[model samples]
Target: MFDYSKLITGDMPGDKIQIGDSHIKRSDTVFPILLKKVKASGKTKIVISVYGGSGVGKSEIGSLLATRFRSNGYGAYVLSGDNYPYRIPAENDRERENRFRYGGLSAIAESDGFCSDWMDIVHDAWLSGADADPELAEKYEFMRDYQEAGKTALSAFLCTPEEIDFGLVNRIIKKFKHGEKQISLKRMGRAPEELYFESVDFSSTKILIIEWTHGNNSALEGVDFPVFLYSTPEQTLEHRISRARDKGVDSPFTSIVLEIEQQKLNEQAQTASITIGKDGELIV
Candidate 1:
């Protein structure tokens, strides 16, 4: 068991982040696997990624694992994937909104037969913040296509190179694997001006672990161990609500985003080195 009182969490986790009993159990389950993987690597410095749903305890478990590594006489450090996005959280969120809204309207605009009256109704729906409601599609059949198109566009943008700076994170991994003692990591916050490079001294960091939603993304490289935390979108949303990491998490748009992200995660699960279920059990 880990000392839950003294864990070093990810760099940019939510201020309201909580470490529950389940987190401790998952870390206990994952620590030995990670240690074996690191030892088998037989390399001077190795990179690992703890990936999963947005609020599936990646930060808490990741920190606990790092603490375990240190207690076992190995050096460890945790890097956050949140800081690798191209834009700060707020700006990136607005961009996601823009992409979604554009996709919905463009689907109708590019149709062979555009309906001005239908567009008028959609305009009204947008004004009332009901454009994304499924019930709206019941009244207007065309809204179903519009909503699906919007969600598809959002899916394309989420976690892709268009949004995340996979190249930058890759370079950092390269440097770490090459035994660089000092590295400059990106730190992105919610506000526009909170972007900066943080110089981290890695002289004693033998195992560099990254805890992130897209940690197993194909775009990212040099991950010796990819540990995935599996959870349904509904479970993830419940966790997000409790964390209150950001506002508007309970919105329909946000729910759709989580669903898309979860779908992608499931698609990527086959390549994961380790998988932890929602109930803190290993998924073979």
Candidate 2:
């Protein structure tokens, strides 16, 4: 129940206008207003998951939605499923080998500056020994023994057209996670540059678009007002093709692989839904 008196008396943070699910136009109006109201009340903490199989434009959709919220002066978060803490060099090699075996280099791993930064966080966390349970540490030490070999294999894998090192990423994640190391302020001092924040500030109704690896169902299990997109495999292919063309990519096979990826995405979207209006209201 919104306080109508607040709006009439110029005491409201913002007006709340309910919108219907099928009414896309109303969504455009109500969302921003409701955001203002939520922010005024200091109760902004919304999480909207956009999950689907790889290549299904999940990231694209999530990114766009986040952009929309940000444009309305909302602090939006755009997270991806692929943002896993993988080891570098070694992880790169393993991915290339797998890509090679699976006909071609379609499903390659991603390694960018952001990924490197995240890997550093995982490494720092491991070094801090935050999760050293003895058994995990023993396993991690064993993996470290083959670091040199893994690095070598990963180095060679970077020659492909896809770009970046994946093995080094995997090893980083493996050691940081299952691997057991204890880090103390005395030993490691501070947290990684990226992992410094204690928590996200959602005082204002901020929009968060999270792309989960486990088909969003895993992430949106109990979330309220979740919006799911329904795109078919063919539609996904067309979407990617359109994206590649927009990005100025002219490879035929690359386009084909993207199409296959679309099929995977269609599967994921079939299981998701979203809130189109303010407070899940029906504003015609």
Candidate 3:
């Protein structure tokens, strides 16, 4: 049997691991051997993405993998995709309504229908080039050096209790889309854009990882290589309740978790029916 713990902890050969009908493999064979070759050749940096659901330990595995790559003396840069930006729950009705109105509009901007509008900003920044932002460019260089050493850069946009405020998400989305002004975070100074540009420069080999929670799996629509952590909905509820207990949060949320788990199981069964017959496999 495949070890779920090993997969979560990311313990396996660089080649691949097979479990049931699913297989987990490295992004590419070149990934494992790139350190010596890239250092000797002095080539441009490479970028990779590691994506998975939350509680499945995406971030933890990403860190360990990045560390291993660095230990091989290869320039490895690991940046978590969670650092982008998002909104938090509103406290009151007024705050919640304001967020809903603004959030609806922002969500439109983030949609595929508004790709041109968003891409315009990207193009303008690219045309203006690095000279327009020498400071950012230099910061990138610093990041490249650190990344070349195999350091994992941890960042996230998930709403934690402390950071939960709809206003913050609006600001982040606005700054991200319009580029009108820069915003700073508590621990990390400067806006996310500034930090992102800086990190890119220091990394010759980049691995981007994201662990998603608090939303639907469809949230990762455009991701290249996506991985889903599969388990029964019963197991999911058990996991959530166990986690909540571990955190000292004794709430009525267990019932809510149970409800969600039931709904998820129904949906999963429906999907399975569509993909495979009662006996499994598709009809010829």
Candidate 4:
């Protein structure tokens, strides 16, 4: 049995709003439930994903879950989704720009069944001088902006499952499942200039925990248990602002990005085995 008491903490104002001390409340509430589910699944190797939008307390809850599993005599490892990015910060900016421009165009062309030659013409028009025809110019501008907006909307989240180094994540998970004793990972940092290597000893590890906003993905096919935490945009914004204040930084853009991320993340909730609502209530 898991020690539920360790996950509890003192009451705080944020708990009422489901942000600060709520991680402890939710984790404690969910620990035994998750443990029972894992045991019932009958899987020798267990993988759990705690996923939610920004400021939804994924890392904190994931850590608490790992502790619970460890105390129960299970070897557990916690992996951060932040440590897996398609590119470093500097390179990612350029990549996003390119993906937004070219990727959107390609998607448009494919969706419309436009031949390469026709796409080339449209592409040229977009790059060439302004059109003399007002209607044509308006159409071109609308298409350009539409594509840019679509990509911008998705990129705002910074790292989606598509952007993660799933190849490495899968490899690590596979090694653990195969009973590998230790593994080294090239972990990513919050900034482009920062990156470091770390090794994990998984010799006795029976459960692997991965948490991220985009943790719900096909790449992680064999997750024994998946937990999805949900929070409204208003609550998320409040939590994000509070966190930013604590960090001594101001980020107005975070609100805009999180608004989009919240919608995307909600759609992913269906993929989870367990879901928790904004009030820290479990949703069956």
Local accuracy by lDDT, each model = 0.87, 0.37, 0.32, 0.66
TM-score of each: 0.95, 0.35, 0.33, 0.70
| Reference-based TM-score, model 1 | 0.95
RMSD of 4: 8.2
Model 1, span 1-284: residue lDDT tens? 34567666677734344778898889888888888888887898888899999989888888888888888887889999999888888889889988988899999887777788888888898787777788887887788888999999999999999999999999999999898999999877787677788888999989888999999999999998899999999999999998887888888778888989999999999999999997778896
lDDT of 4 by residue, 1-284 (tens): 44545442211112212334687788877788899998898877888888887677887788788887888877777777756777764565445445555655655565654455556645565455221223443665545543545457456434555566877778877887777887886666546556777776777778888877777766655566779888888877776676662331123233435656677777777778889876669887
Clashing pairs in 4: none
Q: Where does the lowest 10-residue lDDT sum fall in candidate 2?
A: 6-15
What is the clash count for each candidate, in the order shown?
0, 35, 5, 0
On residues 1-284, what C-alpha lDDT tens digit does candidate 3 reach at each position?
22334332222112122232212222222234434443554433323234322233334434444555555554444434334333211222124223322333344354454544544543453354321233432554432232222111101112222223334333432333333233342112123333322312332333222333321232332222232333444454454454442331222222323334334434433222112121222322
Please give the lDDT score at residue 2 for candidate 4. 44
The list of candidate 2 runs beyond 4 A from truth reads 1-44, 53-57, 70-73, 85-205, 212-215, 219-225, 242-271, 275-284
Each candidate's root-mean-square deviation in Å?
Answer: 1.5, 18.3, 20.9, 8.2
Q: Give the TM-score ranking, best first.
A: 1, 4, 2, 3
